[model samples]
Target: MLPDFRLTDRTVPSAIEVYGIQGNAQYVARKAEKQALYAREGAPCVEWIPPDDLASVQLPPAA
Candidate 1:
């Protein structure tokens, strides 16, 4: 199954308009074909940065 990409009319003023909530629970279930799934098991929530940081975040050099 393909990953779900949520889109709105929101336009981000960045070089690339990459956007969305990634890999939600439903997405995982679908991708796993309803089989037993595993995430971080007992991991804590990730402390994500603010949205604006995404615009300026530098990507790794292309391989």
Candidate 2:
């Protein structure tokens, strides 16, 4: 999966995705699929939904 942001410095796999479009059926389905994939892979996935500013998002510390 291509994440919006990837933390390559982390010891474990970490991904950050920004979901800006909420109403589209295809987009929502894709988001769910990605979440499931992350869970199955035991990766740390962070999801960001608007209207929260990305600048204020609290990201996990790098390793």
Candidate 3:
């Protein structure tokens, strides 16, 4: 799957996902699947649920 932002420079696999849609059930399911895939691959991710979780989402330090 294509991530919203792929952190290619990180020492380990990493990505940033911007979850802009929350009202649709299919989109929500896909989001969960993607998150699970990333976790299973041992990649660090920053998920930004805009208008709410932006401040809470902490990005990983630069490599």
- Say which candidate scores most in TM-score: 3
Is 1 or 2 the stronger prediction by lDDT? Answer: 2
Writing each residue's lDDT as its tens digit, candidate 1 over 1-63 gives 122222232232112223233558774445344222213233111122346565565532332
Q: Rank the candidates by TM-score, best first.
A: 3, 2, 1
Residue 39, model 2: lDDT of 88
Give the residue spans of candidate 2 off by over 4 A. 53-56
Q: Which candidate wins on lDDT?
A: 2
What TM-scores do the predictions have? 0.21, 0.80, 0.82
Task: Report the error of model 3 at residue 47, Å.
Answer: 0.4
Q: For residues 1-60, could you state the per-residue lDDT of candidate 3 as single tens digits?
A: 889998877666578899999799999999999999988988788888877756787767
lDDT of 3 at 20: 92
Off by over 4 Å in 1: 1-48
The positional error of residue 26 in candidate 1, measured at the CA in angstroms, is 26
Candidate 3 weakest ten by summed lDDT: 53-62
Q: Clashing residue pairs, candidate 2?
A: none
The total of clashing pairs for model 2 equals 0
- Number of the candidate with higher TM-score, 1 or 3: 3
lDDT-based ranking, best first?
Answer: 2, 3, 1
